[model samples]
Target: MPPTEAADTIVALSSGRPPAGIGVIRCSGPQAFAAAQALAGSLPEPRLASLRHIRRPGSDMLLDEALVIAFPGPRTATGEDLVEFHCHGGRATVDAVLAALVEQPGCRIAQPGEFTRRALVNGRIDLTEAEGLADLLAAETEVQRRSAMARAGGAFRRRLDEWRERLLALSAQAEVAIDYADEEDGETAPDLRPAIAHLRQEIALLLTAPRVEPLRDGVRVVVAGPTNAGKSSLINRIVGYDKAIVTPIAGTTRDVIEIPVSIGGIPFLLVDTAGLRATGDEVEAIGIRRAKEQIEQADILVWLGSPCEKPAGAIQVASKSDLAQPAERGGLRLSSVSGEGVQELIAEVRQRAAALMPKGDELTLDRRQFRLLGDAEAALTRAASLSDALLVAEELRTARVAIDAISGRAGVEDLLDSLFGKFCLGK
Candidate 1:
């Protein structure tokens, strides 16, 4: 989609294609009601679904029986007059409805994310809330859904508003002090140093909190070990599928095979890598190099080995335990064949992953918001050190601008395009 204002009525399959019981076609713009009336014979009352016989305009040929709902301007999702057609879940039926709407004078197909973009532009939601909505749509696990729900529910935005309000108040206080420093017997400015320090401390705490990005992108757990150590078998058991090929032959698995698995409601990327060992084959050598690289990037490394060969500093797992007793006393011992201690291993991994998750209340800011917050924190930190009210006020203004950027109060036109571009069509 191009970067532009929504000048025409837009239509899209808000509910995805057929095989289900129903499909919804959404239209929003100044002419939304006119377009719906053109096809449905007459517009339904606002916010109420009315059964209608949808037909082609002029020819008056019946398209399908549908439930049509109309919403007048400023109260709808996009803050524009909107219409929805709930029709039979069939490709031909949906296409015919869309075709009829587009044939009208002012209606056309909506671009990807155009609907939500309209919502943002119309003051229905902010950028942070929009991001949360995107996350909610993409969430696949319980934890992801909970986090995204918190964000979309405006919890995170309310917190940011509090912080922004504080900074704005402080900035205003500093400006007032500067304005009256020369006045005779003027009221003395409140000491802002303590307030600046408190704000800095709060921002620092938020910055230091555990990040939730791993929840959005699953936590990576890499299996590293020498050849034929049951790494593939162990991962297969954990994921409950043969995601990786298990063979007794050395160097059988070459390349990184990643499977997503959820343990204890935490999502994880279970990576089965090529065994780490010196290999004569060129392809096997490349795979071994990639395995080492995976180890470096992994959040948790499960070093699968025999009783005597565990590596240092990894979560040691004694593989093929049915064939040999555990060499180490504290490490998790498991036999993939017998399924012994596999659950224990999973529990351990979950504990570690949970440790890495951010607090439930902390918002997962995107890269732009993170950078902006960091800048605000830095500005506040600088303001805390200065005794001069003018310099401190300048720094406070900088911090205020940074905070405002997060909520789209200033300088974010290009960012809006980038953010809305990520959204799929019909949302």
Candidate 2:
């Protein structure tokens, strides 16, 4: 049934690209039930899947036989009437069904993230949950999935709601105090310093936590050593494939080669760099310069050079250990060909990388989220120290605005387009 005539009904293939086992076509809005009824002739009971024949309007041309489910308005995923068609996964089948649905009046193909954008607009899920859904869709590694799951479960939104409630209470107190400043000595504003101080301390601790970037993009582990130190071979061994060209000759790898791999559920990028040496070739010099830059940016440095020359905190490796007798060294001695100590070195890198990620189910924040929290924390800090009720109220408002921006409750109109753009069609 149509909820309203103003809103456009949207339909999209919510499942993966066709040619799979099944395709899920989702429709939501006021006209969703009408469109579904037009094709199926009769609609199924809400939330119950019923097999139906999908056909063109005013014709007996069968589009596809599909299982259909209807969801009535206001409690659905988009907070509107919704329908889904579980149809055969062939491309032609999906295209034909979609054409039939869109041909109905007020029906149109959904834009990327439109369904989810509707979910956000209609108050079904907040921005933090939306962001979590985005991350879940794009997640390629185990840890990333875990982090996104926690976020999509509304952990951040729940916490922010608590904070927003307290802010409103404090704001009301400040208003009352201002309205009766001279007239009522008996109606003193409750001391908000205690709550303000406590809130600020909690937010400060979160500000110290790891950023979400390293988890999204794998942690960088750059391999650096002088020429012919077996840097290329070592990386190929760790990555389980030939990511870099290997040769006995020095200077063969005159550039940086990066390979991304997941170890023990954590993502890592193994970077093979040009051998460091004094080279007259302009190209080799440029490669060396880039290698140095990569080293500076590395989260973990694997040094295959002499132990004494290794940079601070580098994972020192005595390369080509198969050809040379084992040396008495505290660090690792590895042979890429023999596979000795390769797993240990990899374990070490993974251990180091784990510390940089969001710890088991910790709600991590992105760049924008971290910045907004920083703003809110600062406002709370200012509010805690102020004795004037009016000034404290002003600071609390600032904090609330910052917090609201995160949940898409206020001041987030500009963010919707860009944020939803990241989502795939039908999300």
Candidate 3:
């Protein structure tokens, strides 16, 4: 019996790709129980796993013996009835079980991020937490993982909750101030200045915190310098691999090659560009142009040329120090041939990278969250500056709306599809 479309039961293989030792097949929604029962015969005790013979419906052939568990909801992951079939981790075995469940009324395959999205829709989690979960899944470094975990664990949600409460109280106080403006000689007017100031200060602090994008996208470290200054050699040494082709020829590297590597737990994109010079060759000239663009946008620049001519804050490296030392011993002294000063150079890079990174699992805002916080802070600033009760209350309301958006309490319909699309189908 197929269940109605309005009450569809969703099923998916929740674990890693099959052909492993075990695969977890999950089902949720109104038809979860019926779908699981159709395959496993009967449900296990709530939250308890029990062995059951999963078989094809209306057929005598047995499929696989699996451990089955059920979670009745408003208390489960999705806040709905959910069930899990721990089947043998074989592609065919898992597929057979999924087919059996889909045959049940109202059961169908889950879409990408459908499970987590349902959790969000059902009030199990807020937007910050959902974003955190997505971050955790896509994390490529330890810092990224820890930061994502903090977000997924509701750190931002709790912080937003606090901000929202303060904003609401301030809003109510502004309203009261307006209502009782004539009654008392400003005695009844709750002074919102202190609270508003404090809240604004906090928001400002968060705005200054390290952002999540740099951690995810990696620090852009561009290696640039004059012809034959060992630019490629320095980058290859830094990354400890021959990512950039090393040759004595000045124009050997005729393009920008970016190698993403993690150094001392920090993500860095080591970029090797064509040696800078007046080149007449069209291809090399184009590469030089692209290199200049990369240099302009680089977070860190390893310059292997004259220190006086390097970009602002660029780390000048006196490359090929194995030979007689260059007169200009500026920036970090490095010799790729003798492997000297490489560790110190890397340490310097890490020191610079640390300033741009979030410290040890601490929460850092994404671009969207940062922008919203800025709006809330701006509104609160206006509220604090205004003496007119009517204007003050209006500003407070604006602040409230901005704060509400931090955790997705207000309009965020456009963000839902983009955010959920980042997740894998099982998530």
Q: Write the per-residue lDDT of candidate 2 for residues 77-117, one digit (tens) a residue.
A: 98899999999999999999999999999899988888888
Q: Candidate 3: where are CA atoms >4 Å away?
A: 1-6, 140-144, 180-188, 222-257, 271-298, 301-346, 411-414
Candidates 1 and 3 compared by lDDT, better number: 3
lDDT accuracy of residue 427 in candidate 1: 74
Scored against the true structure, residue 30 in model 3 reaches a CA lDDT of: 92
lDDT tens string, model 1, 1-427? 4654567999998887575589899999998988899898898778898999999999868999999999998978998999999999799888899899999988898887889888878877777888888888888767678878777888666767898889889989998888767573767878999999999888777676555566887788999899998899999898888889988899989999989876777778998999978879999999999998989878788988653565555798777778765345346778999998898888888888988775454566655677788999999999999877899999999998988888777798887787778877777
How would you encode candidate 3's per-residue C-alpha lDDT over 1-427 as one tens digit per residue?
1211337788999999989899998899999998888888899899999999999889978999999999999899988899998999999999999998899988899887888888887888999999999999998667778989988999778888898888788888888888888676657677789888999999888888778876888888888988789988988887777888988788999999989998877788888998889989999999999989989978788898887788898988888888997476777778998998899888888899889888858888887888889998998888889888889888888877887787887898778778887788778
Clash count (model 2, backbone only): 0
Model 2 residue runs over 4 Å out of place are 1-6, 182-187, 208-210, 220-265, 270-351
List TM-scores for all candidates, in order: 0.72, 0.74, 0.76
User: lDDT for model 1, on a 0 to 1 scale?
Assistant: 0.84
Candidates sorted on lDDT, descending: 2, 3, 1
| C-alpha RMSD of candidate 1 | 5.6
After TM-score superposition, the amount by which residue 75's alpha carbon in candidate 2 deviates from its true location, in angstroms, is 0.7
Prediction 1 TM-score vs. true? 0.72
